[model samples]
Target: MSKQVVFTIKLEPELRDTFMAEAAADDQPAAQVMRELMRGYIEQRRQAREYDAYLRRKVEVARADKTAGRGFSNEDIEAEFSAARDELGQVV
Candidate 1:
């Protein structure tokens, strides 16, 4: 990976010192840790967006099915299950 750009942020002096000390203790560069954290955050956001799109598509399809009368109603579902249970001698 090529990191040709420098990103700068301002933090409290104590926070910077503590972060540097922790990075030193872990034997890892602070920049590398920050890069990994940034990548993880990006991936999390991407997955959330994909999931949101999937749910929206599902809702749209359900709505279309309802408009076309192509899906079962709640009462229809309950009646079908009740009949199946009766056939199997199971309590409702």
Candidate 2:
């Protein structure tokens, strides 16, 4: 393992007791469970950042398209939806 860093976490008595009981039931220390949870949390955060960047790029590309300036009127949007629904046999 890498160098160790000690840190303190303050938990209410009731929560602390519950955590210890669950940890013992699983036959693993709470610290190990916390590490696993931290790993998953970090992964999700990284994914969210990547998706945000992708969405920003997609929006920039969409704005540069001439068709986007046509900015569908309500009637245009409804007509397109009606055509799609008719093709798909959907209840419009």
lDDT of 2 by residue, 5-85 (tens): 975789899998998899889999988878888899999999999999999998887776636684567788899999998
Q: What are the candidates' C-alpha RMSDs?
A: 2.5, 3.8
Instruction: Summarize candidate 1's per-residue lDDT along 1-92 as a digit string, tens digits.
Output: 99899999999999999998998899999999889889999999999999999999999999999999999989999999999989889653
Cα shift from native, residue 29, model 2 (Å)? 1.2
TM-scores vs. true structure, each candidate:
0.81, 0.69
Best by lDDT: 1
Write down the lDDT that model 2 would get: 0.85
**Which runs of model 2 end up more than 4 angstroms from their true locations?**
66-92
Whole-model lDDT for model 1 versus the true structure?
0.95
Which residue pairs in model 1 clash with each other? Answer: none
What would the TM-score be for candidate 1 when compared with the true structure?
0.81
Report lDDT per candidate. Answer: 0.95, 0.85
Model 2 pairs in collision = none
